[model samples]
Target: MTALLDLVLDAHGGLRRWQDARTVHAEGSIGGHLWSLRGQEGILATTDATVDVQQQRLVFGDFTGPGLRGLFTPDRVAVERPDGEVVAERNAPRAAFAGQGPDTPWDRLHALYFAGYALWNYLTAPYLLTRPGVVVEELEPWREADEDWRRLHVTFPETLATHSTEQVFYYDTAGLLRRHDYAPDVLGGTPAAHFSEHHVRASGLVFPTHRFVVPVQEDGRAASEPVLITIDLTDISVT
Candidate 1:
């Protein structure tokens, strides 16, 4: 399991090399329109964010307006409204931000990314390598990677029910994640989908600078027609 974890890390640019680094930084634009929750008018929005990894903190300023800010730390999360009023706040366990156990694998790593990418930049494959009980099931080739590449799929254990959905990660020859896919578990439940691309290396690590996610429609049809939200990360720092 440890060796397997090492392979995963090496695929993402080596855990040791990433850990020894003091910080990582990134800059980019995030812009997309949201399908109105009520199916009314689409809301177009954009944001500019900076992630400071050493302190495990993030600062985001919405580009669409003034004073929209969000800050995240190891122990707490806070978001500020456009008017500068704190709109929401929460406390979380410190370990939640830390990496997983030695027995963890790619499936758990995918889960971590799915569950936490909305809140933190603490994801790096090494954390998943240590988590226990996560099952990694190899999937047969399902799709072509591109005009010149091939793709592989892997699954995680079901945490919800027998019909509960499992995380699916798509990787290329170099073992970097090129895409992620998952379906809904409950009948009539909205299917969840997430896709990431535009990978680039900065500060000793490979990272996806742009990503988009949407929930499948209630009718079990296609996911949300218009993207609900798109995140653009910039000024990312790992320390």
Candidate 2:
């Protein structure tokens, strides 16, 4: 394991603990005008979500609207109703976005794929770095707010369905992740900076309850104002 990843995993919760805990449950609200822009408003709003950490599967329900349950695996995404009837299913969900851009009109399946994989990736971080095919390297320290923050440049293999293959993670002296940067390949590779804060611990695991994803300028820096997406997670538990 890389020294940086070691520190991060230890800070959040030891790798052994995370490995033993097979799943996590989170009930919360997920909203942002970014969804509206993509024609997927309310798809992920006010939901109860569960993630199978090792299997990389996510199942969520109790959306803002009725008859919407989301199921996502690495290779497929499915939307079902309360009656257990699937409304949409897509194989190789990531490929469904081929030649798509931010302005592309989104369908239910598209929305499911985007939200499902995105949340799965977020809820399983640092620990996910320990998975096979992930490459991690220490970068020069980044100074922000008069503090020297350690940085890790990570490259995810194709097997993982993240926004992009390459991402940068920022950590505080205590080894908790403070920020992450990547371009959403499904969204035409738009650059974004995600900030994590308001950390709360549950069942030996630490999580940031508040997350913000903002647009980045051509120089690959965050925009001056306006967060594009905001995710607030409450009632989080790991077991």
Which predicted model would earn the best TM-score?
2
lDDT of 2: 0.85
lDDT of 1 by residue, 1-239 (tens): 43344555676777667657654444454334422332222112333455443334555554223675555554555566876677665565233324543223322222222222333332443333333444555555444434222332334343211112355555666666655555533222335555566766665677776777666555523365467446566545556
Q: Candidate 2 at 153: error in angstroms?
A: 0.6
Instruction: Write the residue-wise lDDT of candidate 2 on 1-239 in tens digits.
Output: 77888899999988988898889898887777788888877777787889998978998875435657888887988878888787778898888889876678888788777888888888888788888999999999987668788999999999888889999999999999888999998888878989898888889988889999988788756785566778899899998
lDDT of 1 at 141: 46
TM-score of each: 0.55, 0.94
Q: Rate the local accuracy (lDDT) of all candidates.
A: 0.46, 0.85
